[model samples]
Target: MSQHTPPSPVKKGKELILDITTAAFEGKGLGKVGEYAVFVKNTAPGDRVRVRINRKRKNYAEGVLLELLEPSPIRISPKCRHAGTCGGCTWQHIPYEKELVYKSGHVKDHFQRIGGFRDISTEPVIGAPEPFYYRNKMEYTFGDRRWLTDEEVQSGRDIADRDFALGLHVPGRYDRILNLEECHLQDPVSFRILDAVREYALANNIPPYNTHRHEGFLRNLIIRNAEHTGDLMVNLVTSGENDEIMQPFSSWLLERFPEITTVIHTINDTRSPSSEGRYQKVLYGPGYIREYLGPYHFRIDPNTFFQTNTHQARALYDVVLGALDKVPVLYDLYCGVGTLSVYLSGMATRVVGVEVHAGAVEKARENAAENGVSHAVFEQGDMKDIFNDDMIRRHGSPDIIVTDPPRAGMHESVIRQIISILPKKIIYVSCNSSTQARDVALLSEYYRLERIQPVDMFPRTYHIESVAVLSRNDT
Candidate 1:
């Protein structure tokens, strides 16, 4: 959008070798070619690489890494061979220390540029204790067409032999999956489970679902593990009913991996797993597992939203809870499972959690009663609808409010509603800082940015989770 900048250096499909000066937003490498900015994927701050111009825009260009001529001083050899191909762990090559630096930069840039705020303090990113194997849940896709390496293509290997793959989706290619030899993000037992499932599906001739044709037996394989309890839940998502095929396989998994405490068969009749995946039968053990956040225990259903990394999540919650000073009445917007409100119920006279999902509200009530939290209340309704002035006057004003919205951030109407019923403090937790910054900008009219703590929930990746405390400007 800057008029003084020069045109892009290369046209679409052109190739160039450039020196990457810094990391950009979205985990890409930033470089300039004669005042023309270029963003190349799979690169580091000091990397010098050859790139192919994948897309040409008016102000900037997008590129794909073709060759790495020189590695960054901070770059380390990626532990996993499928680092770039798997589309997970985009920052695995960068040193963990440098990764923290870049993550801090991301928060600062988003606030300064997007929110137009210059004085917010962005503390150093809170690093994960164990960077690798930190993720508690991983979903492996089942594709009939497995992605082949360049060497395999060149070697004239039989295409039929490479037909089936139960691994990660190829970046931007949904029809193919890169069969994982090993993955570092989850427990190695997860990789063992992947191998076992793949082997069983192949031996039984259970066809992998084709996203294009929308016909197959196996669609997706989701695995979740309780980090502290070492309890595992394996959910085999299928397109149609094949109890005979899945029943035996689920039993085999429970027998083979004693660590696997639960196995659920999710019969998904719909095309996409996200739209229709539900727990049809608990083949082994309980259908859900309990994850502990401090003394509070949460019954985590396989399909529900729980923090993927529990260790860093605790740190984030502690930061938010520590910021709240006065709470006679508290309102938690976008309160999934009412975890935050439940965690702070004892401190407040009454804690009201507002969520749109009815099932989640039901579960939150169950969780609250299970934890002996009598002061917390959950209301299932749209935030915009429930956060009105009449409702505020009836329920009484809240001393403090906390919201952790989706990546889209709080809607403008919801933000305005919050401004109307201004609380003493607003604790905003978000995964997408870009949208968070925009929303914070709107609230800046009545609230002052007090503190920002960036927590790395997902390590070895570009994603960041931030908890921001905004004080009432009047207060």
Candidate 2:
């Protein structure tokens, strides 16, 4: 196949009768359009469809569903009404069991094909206990326009181009909203609370924030609920215009929904592309939300980073701990708020957590103090700087290293430092499997890939979180 192909006219506005060839680009179904391959959403291998080309790239094309000429046997009707538009669950149309199988293969494929580590043995992907309602965290955007069909728009209903937030933003379009009635990915409480909040906003004449003009009363809403503990945190992203809008909103939420233990507001004045909660204001309850994982209780703020799936997150934490075994001195790199550090402190004689964010480090210290954990220590600095010999002498060379880096994966320098340290065992937890595999390949010289297990942190989405255990190979 040619690496580059000229744009050719697909039938019916670049809509081609294409058959899915294989999985490509984050495990989406791939088909050919002229010489270039087309990535189709909610498609599987052997599926034939007439797809509408959206964006034409040099080597591939992005397409949408026009008509399923011959649907794959694996295709099933998605449960959610907003499945295609919500952007939360792209693989809802694909069977749940099949999705797990495909994800496991996807990780293996990324290592073999992309990372050049063909011999890496991958175990069967571990699935979530409950696929639906597994997500403990959800951040929903507010838009001023409710997306309606052309037929409905023509019926003289004064709806289109009006100031109103439908619900969450559609995949690409920022101006439009998908109007999610209920998301199956989140718990039933989330659905009810979202609906209630939307209704309350509409009733109170609180306008949805316009991303384009940066005007409006409300911008975003985040809901975090713990699975083990029935604790909830609601963070409202607002325009920072008035305290009036929040008084009633917060009052009503606290009174009506007693489960909401932490209700807060964040003033997002900057027109940045970040969805994070900023300049927080406590409306009700405490400054943080609480959750129980095993013997530990975690208090997380709106900006606090907690694993998405609470149940599976515990499992993941256990995997990391098991991989580490019982190292005398351990290091937790990229440790956000030191969740893992606090949990494994008792197991190890001493635990040192290295994080880049100062705020996270403060929170980690607070958590350690609150938990009465004295063996663990948290240092706020770039891991590259903190992993030096001097620091190693002070904290002792980490017998085992447990790092959970960001999606871009660990820095090459950090990886080199890890290899230099030569920890007895390295538990690499990654949200992006491709990057994880790539890093593992780089460390293949010194470390042996003991096991790679894919954990479905975010179900129904293409993203896969994997825990790869690496041990030093004695030649």
Candidate 3:
């Protein structure tokens, strides 16, 4: 007898009521329609929501939430008014404890699915002490096109100056900016500074850079605050240098906010939309601020790459340090500003940090010198190009290797080099778990995954930082 296959329960462009049963990776909510999985965004598990199937596939479907028929029991009111709309925080509505569970589960699931590991040891995700007001840096854009919310459009209020917006870009809409009145990611003082700058720009008729025409003055405003030290920096990126505008503006800003320790003016005359400048000039006080992590102090310039969340960075480092023993030599890959090298220098006989950016390598050396550590050295070269046998010989063979690559994760060539070197222990720190799992799978031939520790460096968001410790099989 032949059996007939049933059709899909949901159809493209069709609306249906779905009960979210679980959470999926990347802040998606998972629901099933007749055993067929449906993924919806901006929803929580145990939520009864009305969803419209936007994209249909043979196995699963993607949906957009239309209405929340019933809120989940684990859901809570978001602290920020822009929680659902802003691209900054995704799991704001979910309870923080539940969020940590989801994040930890995500790490385990990645290792199982991507790395093909079944019985790897996984630790509970370490939660942040404070969720809101944790970010040390905030970068805002100046846009001419403001995105209006549904509430604003429904109220029928006459909005003024729709061409001016001084906040973050709308999610999935790079050209449209949402005029944020408040943001919880950074401290309260950041919002105050944001408002002050917006008011000043509107009052003085300073034009925001237009991406389409590539003609305007103001581009981006970046704020950096020291978590341990009470220092603050404000970096203003503009299309051109105009002393007539900046001289008075800096004076007024400093006068208004005396807590602001430094103000920098960066110029980008070209059409590129990058916040980075061609050259920068100090408008007030010093051009850089000092930040402290553990016993070491780091000089943070406008372009310097430092950990965004300061409080949890210490905890994350503690995890790395806990897994280390007194070693003859340690190699830090993609080491920006030598934070890890300096932090772990106390236990290692010598530390070598390699980075691609010349500026970051210079800052790393300066930090090492400032910390009075002569045992650590910073080198400048692309990891794939310089991490070879010659480089390994120049710097003694490392007993242990610690790598903290970017979100894109480490390059395959660099991973191959590490495998060839066969260090006794490799500590992998990554902000993205999927790529980390893939890299670990690639190294599974010679190394055994010892432990995976997930740290919630960023709360109220789906982003997670994980530290994977592995040891050589023979050792």
Which of 2 and 3 is ahead in lDDT? 3
The segments of candidate 2 whose C-alpha lies over 4 angstroms from its true place after superposition are: 1-13, 25-27, 33-36, 149-162, 273-278
Q: List the RMSD of every prediction in angstroms.
A: 2.3, 3.0, 1.7
lDDT value for model 3: 0.92
lDDT of 2 at 338: 90
Q: On a 0 to 100 scale, what is the lDDT of residue 430 in model 1?
A: 96
Among the numbered candidates, top TM-score falls to 3
lDDT of each: 0.87, 0.82, 0.92
lDDT of 3 by residue, 1-475 (tens): 9998888898999999999998898899999998999999889999999999999999999999999999999889988888888688999899899999999999999999989998875899999989899999999999999999888999999999899998999988988999998999887888899999999999999999998988889999999999889899999999999999998989999999999999999999888878888999999988999999988899999998889999999999999999998988999999988888899999798899999999889988998999998999888999999999998899998999999998888899999999988999999999999999999999999999999999999898889999999999999
Off by over 4 Å in 1: 1-8, 155-160, 275-279
For every model shown, what is its TM-score relative to the native structure? 0.96, 0.92, 0.96
Expressed as tens digits, the lDDT of each residue in 1-475 for candidate 1 is 6678544468999999989998887789999888889999889988999999999988889998989998888888899998878898888888888888899999988999999998777988889989999888999988888999766689886766477888898888878899888999988899999999998888889888888888887888888998878789898888877778977898788788888889888888776657237447788888888888898988888777888889988898888888887568988889988777788777788888889999989988988998999988888888878778876776778889889999999989999888877888999999999999999999999999988889999888889999888999889
Query: For model 3, what is the alpha-carbon lDDT of residue 244?
Result: 96
lDDT of 2 by residue, 341-459 (tens): 99888778999999999999998998888888889998889877877787788999988888899999999989988887898888899988888888988998898888988888888
